[model samples]
Target: MLIGGILRDSSFFCIKMSAYPFFYPMAFPQWKEKLLYWADSRFSYFALTQGNEHSYPQNPFDSCFFAGNKELSENDLWQKRAFKVGVLGYDFKNQIEKLESNNPEFFSLPDLCFFVPELIFKIDSEGIYASSRLSAEFLSEIETQVIPETGSVTCKISPQITRESYLKSVQNIQNEISEGNTYEANFCQAYSGEFETWSPIAAFLRLNQLSRMPFAALFKAKNNWLVSASPERFLKKSGSSLIAQPIKGTIRRGETASQDSENRKKLLASEKERAENLMITDLMRNDLARVSKTGTVRVEELFGIYPFPRVLQMISTVCSELNPDTSLKEIIRATFPMGSMTGAPKISTMKIIEREESFKRGWFSGAFGWIDESGDFDFSVIIRSIIADSEAKKLYFGVGSAITIDASAAQEYEECELKAQAILELLRGN
Candidate 1:
C-alpha cells in the first residue's frame, strides 16, 4: 500500500505543512538512525506523553536555522520528501542530540520555519528549499505488500511479569498516596518484538482509517521512533502571536448523544479534571511568557471540550503576543518541554518523572511541527502514539497520566486504555 501527501496541519502553529511517510509508534528509533546517517546536519525532535505506553518523538523533516533576520523563507522555498519520510518527536534529551548528530541532514533551526509534514512525507533534501513539488508522490517511494490475514500476534513479552506484579505497582502508588508522597504517579512498561514484515507506514494508514484525526504524524529518529494519531494541541504560532492548548479532563465517548452530553457535563464539573487542566494552563501561560511580550499572555478560552472517538477532553486555549526581541530558537528553548506532560512545578515534576519512571521518555512529551520563513512555527504534543525501532525488532506502546489526590487507579487505567486504543487497533490488524 502506498500512502502519500499525508501532510500534518499543526493545530498549535495555526500553519499548515505537508507530512511525508508515516509509521507505527515503534519505528522511531531505527528511522532516526537512518535519517541521521544520510542527512548532513543535526535537528530537533519533540515527542509527547499521552498516558502509559503512548508517546511520540517530534523531528523536522526539513529545517533551516535562524540568526536574527537570517530568515529561512525565500520566494522559491518548499518542503522536501524522501524514500522514507523520516519523523522525530518526543524527547530523551541525550537521545535526541545523538539522533541529530546521526542524521546530519536533520535540522534544528533557531528562528527558521518549514513544513514538517512536507519534509517528512512529501519533500526531500534536494527539494527542501525548492519552491514547488512538495507533493508526497514528488518525494517518497511508498510500497505495500499483501499478506495473509494473521489476526494473532505470535510473540509475547520476555520475562513477563504476572498480573500480580503489575498490580503490585498500583498498590505501591496507593501506598505513596497513603503516605502523602504523591497522589498519582505515572508508570510505564515496554514489550519488544521482531516483525518479519510489520510496516509502520501500513499500520499508520490503517490507524488513520480508524481515527480519521485531522492532524497526525509518523516520524523516525535514529535510535528511537514514533507514529501517532494524536488529536491534541500543545502550541502554535502565527506572525507574532503564540497560542497553546492543553488537554486535561476526559470522559469516554458515549453510545448516544444524550449520554455524550451527560459525559461532557460531568467532565466540565469534575474538580479533579478541572484542577489538572487549570494547572497545565497556568504552566503553559508561564512558559509562553518567557518569549511573549510582558503582560501579553492571557487565557483565551478555558475548559473547552473537544470530543474524540474514544473519549471527551477538556482543553483550554491560551494566547500571547510574541516578543519582537525574541529569537525563534529562544522561543522553542523556553517551551521545548510543554507544561501539560510535566505537571505543575515542571522541574520538580520532571525530576520526579525521571526518578519514578523506568525508562527515558526520549521524544515523548516533546513538540513536533514546522516553522516557516515568516518566523511562524507550529507544533503538536506527541500523544496517542506508538514507538517503533524496527531494526531492534522492538515495538513499544505506553500510557501515562497526571495524578492528584482525587485520581482513581481504575479510572486512570481506563484513561490509559483510551489513549492506547488506536495503536492497539492497528496491532489487532485493523
Candidate 2:
C-alpha cells in the first residue's frame, strides 16, 4: 500500500492507478461527466462507485473498461466484450520498479479473488467498473437509436413469464430428467420486443425494490462484465482463509408483514430447500479447499435465512484458510461456474448447459472484480446482469433458481420475475 499517495481518510475510496488515478466518495454528482470527457485522453481510467444501494449519487460506477480485454474480431469468442478479468489501478505503483525481479504474470494478473473491503483500488485498467451518478438518471439521456444491426437475433418473450408457463417449464425439466436427461440446464427465456427494452437499472429497482441482504452491487467489470444487482458473494480471500457464500433456496416475500414472517419460517424448515442449500454449500467448501489448508475448510454458516425484496433465501458460508502456495487462478478454475449457477457435479452440469442453452454465457456466470498488484481480489458471481456488445448493440440477462423435485414452478417463476425487475423497468419507453 502506498502510504504517501493513498486516497487519505477514505477507507473505501482509492484507485490503483498512479498515472490517471480515480477515487471518489459514495456519491458524486459530476464524476461521470468528468470521466466521459477525460476517458479518451487519460493514460488510464476507472469505473468506480456503487449504485445498487438505491440511494444517493444514483449513478454508480458499474462498467467494465479496458483495451486489454476487448475483442478485436467479430469471430472472436470475447470480441466486443470486456469480461476477461485483469488487474488494474495503482496497487502496483511501487511494484513497477521491481518487475525485473519477479514473474511478470504475477505482477500483471487476472481478477480471480476479491479481498480488501471498501478501499477503492484499480490496476492496469482491466476489471469491472461503473460510472458514479451516470446510472442515477442514465435513462433521461438514453434514447434508443434503432437497435444496432446484429448477427445475433433479437429475442422476445413469446409467453410472458406467468405462474402457468413457469410451472409448466419446471414440469418439463423434471419430466426430461425423469427420462434420465440432465440435472440443471439454465433454461432462460426472453422478456422484450425488438424496439422495447428492459433497462437494467429499472429492473434492479423493481425486483430488489426490497432486500435485506448486504453487499449488493451493480458492477460493470467491462461491457460483457455486468451484474445488475447481485446480492450474494461467490468467494473471497483474506489472509490465509478463503470464503464463499452460495445462496441456494428462495421464496417470494409475503404480501403482508405477518405473512412474510410466516414465509420466512417455512423457508427455514423446508427439508428440500435445506438439502439444496447444503449441496451447494458443500460444493463451495470443496472448491475453497483446493487452495486451502487441509482440515481448514469449514462451513461458517449453514442455511442462514436471508430476506430480499422479492423473496427469502437460504445462504451458507464456507471458508478455508488457503494453502500457502496456492494461486488465485487455481482457486477460481476449481470453483467458478459457481454451484448456485451450475448444479451439483458442476462439470457435467456445465456441459449440459452449454449444449442446451442457445447463447454463450460470455461473462454471465463468470466472476468479475478487481485484483490489485498483491493478488488481493474481490469478485461477484455474474447473475442479474446485462450483457451487451456495444458494436452490435444487443443486451442479455437471465434469471433462474435451482430445480429440485419439490420445487414449485409458480414460485420459481415469480422469483425470476423479481430478478428481472430492474432490466424490465429500464426499457419502459423503448
Candidate 3:
C-alpha cells in the first residue's frame, strides 16, 4: 500500500525510516533475488553490486533503485540533470565530438534512467539493514512481501568473429603499432547465443559467484539486461578527489597454485605488460588533468597485479584533485571511453578500433553505476559482462585485450577466449 500510494507522489523526496536499522535474517542470494523480482516488475531500474560478501571502501553497498514504473529511453540523458542511479551505454561515445560509432543499435538497453530507491538495503558482516524515508506502514508492508524463486536459464552460443578473423584483426593492430599510428589498441570480438532459459537476474548471480570483483552491476530495461562482473573501476568521486583504476595487462591463471603464483610474478616482471600499463596510466593522467587542478594528477599504484578467477591483471591507480569548475559533462568529455578499453593516444586508437572490430560494443566498454544528489558518484567499466534480450532470445558477450607492440596475435586471441570463459560456462547452463 505504501509503494502503491508513494509511487504516485511525484514530489516524493525521501522515505521515513525507523529509529534503528532492522536486521533481516536472509541470505544475500535470496535478498538479491527478491530485489531483482521487484525491479523486473518496475519500469526503469538498476542495481549496483560489488559481488563480494565483504564490504570495501569503494564498494560499500549492493543497492537497487527504480525511477518510473514505466520504461523510457530519451536521448536527453546527457542534458545536465542529476541522476542518482542509471546506466550509460557505450554508444554514447558518438554524442561527443571526438568519437564515432557505426555499429548497429540492435540492443534496446542503450540508455536508461531510474529514480532513487524508495527502498534501500545495506548488507555487511553484521546483518542486512533496511533504510527508507517512507512511512513505517510502507516499511512494514515491504517486510511482509514474499519474493518468488527464479527458474534456470538455457543458452546456445555462436561466435560473431572466428579465430582466424580475430587473429587477422590482431595482426592489423600490430601493423598499426609498427606504422606509428598508435601505441596500443584494444581489439574486441563478439559471441552471441540463443537462450531458452534467459533470466538476467539468475545469470548475474552465477557470474557473481564465479567472479567476485569490486565493481559488478545489474541493469535491466524492459527486455534488455546488462549483467556484469567487472573488476575495473572507471571513476569514483569523494569530495574533490577523483580516482580511477585502469587495467591493462592480463594473463590466464594456472591450473596449479604454484603455477598461478608464477603467472602473477611473470606478469609483474614482464617489461611488456608494465609498458602497456604505464602508457594507459599516462593517458588517464592527461585526461584527468584537463578537469583537475594543475599538477594534481598522480599515480597511486603502478603495475599492481590483481588476480581474478580466470586471469591475473596489471592495474594502475590514478587520482586527481578536481577543479571547482569541472562539470559532469566536462569529466565525461575528457574521458568518455576509458583508457583501459581504448589504448594509448585514445583518439587515434579508437578510430583504428572502429575500423578493425566487426561489431559495435553497445554498453560493453562504457561505464555505469550510481551518482547521488551531492554530486558524488562511482562507476565501473562494463567488461566481463553479458547483454541479453529475452524477447529475441539473444545474448551477447564482448571480450578484448589491450594490444601493444610486444603482443602476439595468437596469444591475444587466446586471451579473449580466456576472459570470456566464466560467462561462456554459465551460458552452457553449468
Model 1 clashing-pair count: 87
Please provide TM-scores, in order, for all candidate models, with all chains considered together. Answer: 0.66, 0.63, 0.87
For model 2, residues 37-97, the per-residue Cα lDDT tens digits are 2332221222332434332111122332332213122122112121223222211211222
Instruction: Give the C-alpha miss distance for residue 71 in model 3, angstroms.
Output: 6.6
Best by lDDT: 3
What TM-score number comes out for model 3?
0.87
Per-prediction tally of clashes: 87, 46, 7
Ranking by lDDT: 3, 1, 2
Q: List the candidate numbers ranked by TM-score, top first.
A: 3, 1, 2
Q: RMSD for all candidates, in order, please.
A: 10.7, 11.6, 3.7
> Model 3: per-residue lDDT, tens digit, 1-430?
3563232332322222342245555433455466466556644555646546433334423433343443333534333343455666777767765677876544555544444544344544333454434445533434554664445655788888788888888888999999999999988889888766667877787888887777777776557778888878888877798988899888888999999999999999988889889999999999899899998999988988876777888888899999995777678778878888989788888899999988878878888776654566778888999988888878788999889878888888888888988988888866
User: How many angstroms is residue 147 displaced in model 2 relative to the true structure, after the best TM-score fit?
Assistant: 22
Candidate 3 off by > 4 Å = 4-22, 27-29, 51-83, 111-116, 125-127, 133-150
**Model 1 lDDT per residue over 1-430, tens place:** 1113323233212223433223222222333223322221232332221211222112212232111111223222232221112222444333312322122111232212222322332222232332223344423322221232542333232312233444455566556557755534444433334455465545554565677443466544433456677666666776788888877888888899999999999999999899888878888899899888889999988998877667887888889999886765567666656677766566544544554445555445565555554556556676666666656656655566766656765676667667767766667654
For candidate 1, the per-residue lDDT at 320 reads 93
lDDT values for all models? 0.53, 0.49, 0.72
Better of 2 and 3 by TM-score: 3
Better of 1 and 2 by TM-score: 1
Which residue pairs does candidate 3 place in steric collision?
15-133, 15-134, 16-133, 16-134, 67-115, 153-197, 154-197
